[model samples]
Target: MINIQLLNKDFESRVRLGIMSILMVRDWVEFKELKELLDITDGNLASHAGALEKNQYLQVRKEFVGKKPRTTYAVTQLGRKSFQDHLAALEKLLGQP
Candidate 1:
């Protein structure tokens, strides 16, 4: 039997899932790029990213390029492992392995 508890609460939201999914492939992504890719508003992205940050699952970097401010995000090592475990649980739940 599958254990529902294996699923991570931190990634319950599709937004968070998307964020991690993107970061899993790319080294880093800027805030605006993530917003556009996820088709979400600034506030929406910020809130979700904030949650992941609080959980230590993501890294947020803020800096300026010339006069423009830039925010970027990447998955932490803990996040990578957690997300992988979550995916494995999902696959097991689906009877894929």
Candidate 2:
């Protein structure tokens, strides 16, 4: 029997899932890049990122490149483990082992 409870509520949102998915492979991704890749508005990304940040699943860095302000995001150690576990649960639900 598949345990739906094993799935993480924090990653329920597709936006959040996409964010974490991108962060999983990349060391860091800029706000603009993330928005572009996700095909979401700035406010949409900000809201979703804020939720992930609140969960301690992600780290945000803000800095300036010369005169330009820049923001980047990365997944934390806890996030990696949590996301991996979530994937495992999903796989089990799919009967993939």
Candidate 3:
């Protein structure tokens, strides 16, 4: 219901929110780790990640983990700032500020 104005046109999905919420507390997260955390199917996870990636809210690096391809995502400095702003705005909207 437009809970927040959004930091970007993107970064607005519930899945993206979940991913950003978790990443806010960590250095980086693996693709599978995010999928598990959000309890999302592979396709869902990839799509949301793709949106965030396109908006430059995340930095994704694909590599090999034990001969298997692995994707890792990290919040960029801009992303950290944006997330903070987004949270603060949400709080304000909820009359918490």
Candidate 4:
């Protein structure tokens, strides 16, 4: 039987999934750093981040550092739980657990 629970609609996109994956391991990530790592344009990254933020899956913080505005993103507790569940589902589908 197929495991429909393995699918996470919110994480279906490669970009979003990548973002969450990175956030899972890091404390926080700078906007530019994520953009560079994802090799995506400013607008593209913003759109993806916005979606995650809107879903309350991540938190966005904007601060001025030495007169430069810095925007950072971090996964929320809810996000971490959800991502872990999604990963578990995938592992189950793969018969790893």
- Name the better of 3 and 4 by TM-score: 4
User: Candidate 1 lDDT, tens digit per residue, 1-97?
Assistant: 6689999988989999999999999999999999999999999999999999999999999999999999999999999999999998888889944
- Residue 82 lDDT (model 1): 96
- Model 2, TM vs. native: 0.95
Ranking by TM-score: 1, 2, 4, 3
lDDT of 4 by residue, 2-21 (tens): 68666778998989999999
> Which ten contiguous residues of candidate 4 have the minimum total lDDT?
88-97
lDDT of 3 at 60: 95
Global Cα RMSD, each model:
1.4, 1.5, 3.1, 1.9
Model 4, residue 70: C-alpha shift (Å): 0.7
**TM-scores across all candidates?**
0.96, 0.95, 0.85, 0.91
Query: Which candidate, 2 or 3, would have the higher lDDT against the true structure?
Result: 2
lDDT of 2 at 19: 98
Ranking by lDDT: 2, 1, 4, 3
Q: What is the C-alpha lDDT profile of model 2 across 1-97, one tens digit per residue? A: 6689999999999999999999999999999999999999999999999999998999999999999999999999999999999989988899945
lDDT for each residue of candidate 3 in 1-97, tens digit (9 for 90 to 100):
4465454445567888999999889888999999998999999999998887877789999999798999999988888888888877776677744
Q: Please give the clash total of every predicted structure, in order.
A: 0, 0, 0, 0
Badly placed stretches (over 4 Å) of model 2 are: none
Clashes of 1: 0
